[model samples]
Target chain A: MQLFFQHLINALQWGSFYALIALGYSMVYGILMLFNFAHGDIFMVGAYIGFGVATALAALAALSALALPNWVILVLTILIAMYLTSFVGMLVERIGYRPLREAPRASAAITGLMIGIILETGNLAILGAQRIRFPSLIKTQVYDIGGVVVTNKKIMIVVVSLVLMLALNEFIKRTRWGMAMRAMAFDYVVIPLMGVPLNTIASLTFALGSALAAAAGILFAVAYPVLDPYIGITYGWKAFVAAILGGRGSVKGACLAGFLLGFIEIFVGAYLSSSLRDLIAYSIILLILVFRPHGFFGEPHSAKLRL
Target chain B: MRKGLLLVVAILVVGLALSPCAWAKSKTIKVGINAPITGDIPKVGEGSKYAAEMWLEDIKAAGGLQVGGEKYMVEIIVEDNESKPESAAKAATKLITEDEVLAIVGPQASSQAIPAGEMANNYGTPMISPWSTNPDTTKDRPFVFRGCFLDPFQGPVVANFIKDEFGFKKAAVLYDIASDYPKGLAEVFKEAWENINGPGSVVAFESFTTKDADFSSQLTNIISSGAQFLFTPQYYNEVALIVQQAQELGFKGPIVGSDSWGSAETVKLCGEACYGLFFSTHYAAAGATGATKEFIERYEKKYGYTPDDVGALTWDALRLVQKAIEDTGKLTGNLKNDRVAVKDALAKIKEFDGITGKMTFTPEGDPIKCAVVVRISEKGEFEFYKSACP
Candidate 1:
């Protein structure tokens, strides 16, 4: 039972990353009806940006006149990294997707993949092939409740992810921009006719998704503490699965499915052979998708047949 | 136009006919270095390159290698393997056939070395892998040799070390199933442990694929299995995550590692979490004497950091190649005969005293040598702990 709880905590933390990254895929697909294949690379870029910001802040903290606490540095690093990485996301959208808005959807999807490769190789070319160790911002503290073990970092990661998810939910549910986005998701062609700026909404959607991915990247670094150029490829693909499993453009479903995927993966590995973890976990997901073809929250006939 | 074409064909034919004779008469002996310079484990390639360069400097100062009564210039041709098995084999083919090197130095990791060694053996070229410890690398290939001890030898050394040091009975192993080196070492360690403590003594044996950053589930299983220690034979990148994750999961037992932890980046990336942990390696850089100390001091002075086990073993491998080349008495100007002579000389060598340790080559071209257990000191240095020998 204690072991089960431990696995649950592990699953939650692992799922939080997928949930955050899946939100990017979900939001962009929700607004534009195109899969942002470069979203995973955006997550990678966010983590590297976080590493840079944290390192610079730590250096500044070392000075006698400009001393700052580690927690303050951590907060500043996350905010500043997210802010900077959002610009990167917006730039990618403007350069890679904007011109292809009228072209074939397949062309835009291919552009996303090309952009992802460019970001990966570009980071590799700039940083070289060395693995950068993420700065340890928070000291890890382990707590044992009964027979189950948890760490302060793990708790902080879960809380921060949930708080961000709630904030995003509220923002979409309450704000004027939120209404515009929903209207756009409902019918992008007619919403633009209703005095809604298509470009601004698209850019805003990308910015919001990238910021969340940046937060996920920083929190992942705090837990894992290792940074590399290709960290986003596998992770981005996994989160894309989460976004699909959650149903198209369903925010709450995406979050729930992200955690569900994590729980299934962790529990499978914990109970069965670790070697068969991915094989069995994805097989179960395949079965679920087989029955619910449109996923848990997707509307029937909502996927328009453009051809 | 017909006369010009005829003249060009004649010139090309003469150039091709005279090339081999010209190459044979050349006074320089080329040695090939096949290293992973730009791929996953670039640090291993960097170490091999630096060590080879340092060796070349000494040769240059002495006016090149003295063979028989003549002094011949030595040249090293480095080919990047990109840390891939296919690339390694391709690099070896290029080095042996195109560069026409007398001996080849590295394609360090077993995944690369095993394939590259086959190319060398098929072409009848002598090759030595400085850091490959898998038995199959030199199993049936006479032309292939290695500087480090094999995994079968290392597994028992580590198992016995744990048994004597802590007297721990229950053991747990976590390794990368996708990698050849860790997978082979993990199985060997499991067998060695079970042999000592009886069957089912290895309480938990878990594995994950490459590039996996999370090991919480596997570590949780290992912890709940009532195992006393954790053994992971993964490389430096995965080592940092595994150790940190293991500690965070409330694992209190000692986490031991294999020689794959012998990279300068391990301590740099792992930080204080790896301090006081132990791993078996070729040689400890913290405490040394005589030639080994001099080599370490010079290398550190030049490279701005202490050299790791790969650097040390590479130096020994290069020196071994040099000794064999010189032992042949003379280069016969025929590339084939010189290569044969070098191979024979290498086989005839009885004992070699390397910076790592004294080594005696077996018929299979592996060294009978000692493995040292190094403790990561508080200051992040590889401190020598104890030595275990075959």
Candidate 2:
């Protein structure tokens, strides 16, 4: 029972991060009937930005010889990171997504791939192909949630993710632009017809989603604390899988899928042999795709990638 | 007049460029270095090339390489493999068949080195891998020999350190399964650790991908599992991230790793977060004795940065190969005899005081080098601790 509870804790903690990432993926997919192949990279960008800003601030403090307090430095660095990452996300949408909006689906998908490569290669060139560790907002501490061990980091991850998610949910549901976004999701032709301001909405969606990813990236650093150029690629792909598994276009589904995916992974790794864990988890995902092709919670896709 | 001058200058530049390979007589024996010039692991490839270049310069300046009855200059032909396995194999094929190299020096990563090893083995050409620590790269391959210890040896080096030095009862393990390196290291570490401390002491064993952005989940469970120490055998990139996350998850206990942590990138990436983390590596620049000072000085003069363990190993590999060629005095002869002579010479060699340590190869083709334990200082630099080969 203790082992089971421990595994459950493991699942919940991991699931939160996965859900946060998947939320970014699902939101982008929802707003633009396009899969931002680079969303995962956007997450990476956020984390690297966090790492860079923190390091630079730390260096500056060293130069002045002030030796700033850890928390003040950390918070200032994270805010800078969030702003920079959101800007990058907006830029990606502008340069990468804008040109191909009206082009052939193949071209748009190719452009998305190119964008993915561009983000990775750009990161490689700028960051020099090394992983940079991001400083946590605070030091880690452990606590118990119902006799199951939970760290302060995990609690922060869970709380922050929930807050951002709720905020995003509120923004979409309560706002006028949010209604238009839903209308656009229903039909793009009706967007301009309804004077919904399509471009602004798209940009806002990218910004919001990007910022969310940035926050998630920060929390992830706080939770895990390493930033690599290619990290986004793996997490992005997994988050995409989560998004699809939970019905890619649905915000709730994406979040649910993320948590579920995390739970499955941790539980399997805990129960089954670690070696078999990856193969089994991925195999189960494949089986789900085989059986329901539309994912467990994913809606009947108008257009989606199964490959 | 302008056109004629331009043509003449172009011709002169071309001639100058071609002089190295074109003006070379058949008397010079060429060694090929296939390097990972691009990609995430470029530093490893770059280090190998830089070290090889330095060694080449030292050997050439010393009046080339001595062949039988005459001295022949050692010519090194470097090809960029771009860090791809296929590219490495292609480079090997091109170097052997087209460039007609007497022997090859590199193809760094084990995944790349294996196929390159196969290419050399097929042609019976000697190839010295500088830092490909995966055991399979040399196992059963007649021509493939390494200048570094295999992952199995290196991994257990740290695992035993964790068990014996720290006296840890249990360890939480995390390793990237995608790499033959980390995969192999993680396995060997488990075997060695459990052998010493018994099984079930490892409470949490988790695997991650090379591209995993978040390892906190794994670390969380590890933190809760009551494991006394953390064991990770990961590349510099992953190690940086792992250490940061590990530290964030409140893991202050000694974290032990393999030689894969022998990178400045690990320090740069982890920064102050990596303080006190320990790893077993081939070389650390403390208490320099024997060839260590000489290597560090020469390398610093050339590269302007401190040489890491991999760099030291590659330099040693180059020197060892050159020594074999010079001793045999048959390196400049027909490719067959030179190859045979170098291979035979490498096998018969007993001892060399290398920067890493006193080294010799076992008949089974593993480097008999000491693996040293190094601790990451508070300022994020590696300080040497101790070494054990016994």
Candidate 3:
């Protein structure tokens, strides 16, 4: 039982990265009715941007000119990286997606995939093939509670992820931009009739999603501290699955499903043979999706109608 | 009409610019390097390339390889396999057919080397794998050869090291199911451990796929199972993550690994978390002498980091190929006969002195070599521990 709790703690932290990135996929899918397949590469780009900004700040601090602590520099790195990466997300949507808006959905999906390849290869070309090590921002302190061991970084990751999700929930509930997004999801033609520009909502959605992915990227760096060009490929795909399982256009569903997927993967690997973890975990998820095709919080409506 | 004429002229110019292979002389021996140059393990590829280049430079300085009193300069052509098995086969085929090289050097990983070795066998070209240790890499292929010992051999080396040095019977294993090297090494180690320490001595056995980054669940089980030590034979990237995660789970026992953990990047990636871990490797830089020491200093000067076992094995493979080419008496300028001669010569190599150490090939083309065990000190350096010979 104690071992179960220990794994649960790990599952929570692991799920936070998925939940954070999945929100980007769910939101972009919800608002624009287009899956940002490049979102995973965007997450990768965000992590690299985080690495760059964090490295610069750490170097500056090492100069002893700023007299700033590591934690303060880390906070600044996360905020700045998110802001810069949001523009990248917007640029991708603008140049890549906007050109194919009137084209077939397959074209947009293909464009997203192409953009993903470009980002990955571009990073490889620019940075060379060497893997970059993310500088440690916060000192790890292990907190022993009964038999379960938890690190300060793990707690911080979980808490920060929840806080970001809550903030996003509040923004979507209370802001006019959130209202515009909701209207766009329901009917794009109707949203323009309400005097809100369609392009503005699309860009805003991409921006928001990219920012969340940036947060997840920075948090992942905090835990793993090893940054490679291709780290986002598998991570992005798994989060996309979480986004779908949570239900289309449902933020709450994405969060819940992300954690659920993490729990399933962890428990399966722990209780059963780890070799069978993905086989059984993904199979269970497939059964759930088979019964509920629209997903847990998805509406029984066509995606075209939502667009 | 003018645009069309200009386009035709441009095509002619470009075609002329690219057809230099048609005018190449056959005086020099053409060697193909089939390494993974651009994908997941580019560092491994880069190391192999540099090692080959370093040997070529030294060979040129010594007035090239003498065959029947005729000296032939070596020319190396590198092809990127993109780190995939099919890509490796395609690269090897292209090297044999298009480039028409005499002998080839790599396809470093077992997954690539196994398929590429088969292709070399089909083409009747002698190919030596620098770092691939899986038994299947050269099992049935007479034309194929390897520089490193088989995974089965290293498995007992690690198991016996832990038993004799650490004296730990109870152990845990976590491996990558999708990877050929890690999976093969893990199975061999488990069998050896059980045979030496008794059956059911392994308390926990877990696995993850190639795409997995989180290993906390498996670590939790291993910790809770009360195993005295852990064995993970995955690549350096995965090993770095596993070590960090293992430490966070409060498992303080010694961690044992394979040659895959012998890279300098493991320390850079994992920081202090990988300190004090032990692994069986090809060569250790500490306490080295003669050619091994010289190779280490030159490699460290050329590349920023110290040479790992992969780099050393690649150097060994290059020297072995050069020696085989010279031992065949002459190139003869006949591709088919020369390739056959090289293959036969490589088979007859009774002994080879390499930077990795002395090695001799078995009838099956696998090397009978000594495996060195190294430990990561508290300062995060690979310290020489001991050597295990078969």
> What would the per-residue lDDT of candidate 1 be over residues A1-307, giving only the tens digit for each residue?
8888999999999999999999989888888988999999999999999999999989988874569999999989999999999999999999999999999999999999999999999998999888889999889999999988999999999999999999999989999999888888888888799899999999999999999999999998998887888888989999999988988788887898899999999999999889888999999999999998767887666543110
* C-alpha lDDT of residue B249 in model 2: 50
Candidate 2 lDDT, A1-307, residue by residue in tens: 6557766765776777778788777777776778877788888888878787887877877797867876778768767877788788788889988888887767766777788888888988876754455655466666655655667766767877888788778877898877777766666655578677777777877787777777777777776665657777777788888988877678888788888888777766656645566678878888877887766655675543111
Model 3 Cα shift for residue A267 (angstroms): 1.8
Q: lDDT of each model, Cα atoms only?
A: 0.92, 0.76, 0.89
Enumerate the candidates' DockQ scores in order.
0.69, 0.26, 0.72
Could you tell me which residue pairs clash in candidate 2? A224-B245, A247-A298, B68-B329
lDDT of 2 at A16: 77
lDDT ranking, best first: 1, 3, 2
TM-score result, candidate 3: 0.96
lDDT digits (tens) for residues B1-390 of candidate 1: 999999999999999778873455479999999998877788899999999999999999999999999999998989999888899999999999888899999989999999999999999999999999989899899899999899999999999999999999999999988878999999999999999999999999999988888999999999999999999999998999999999999999999999999999999999999999999999998879989999999999999989989999999999999999999998988888898899889888889999999999999989999999999999999999999988
**Per-prediction CA RMSD (Å):** 3.7, 5.6, 2.5
Compute the lDDT of residue B12 as modeled in candidate 2. 92
Candidate 1: docking tier:
medium
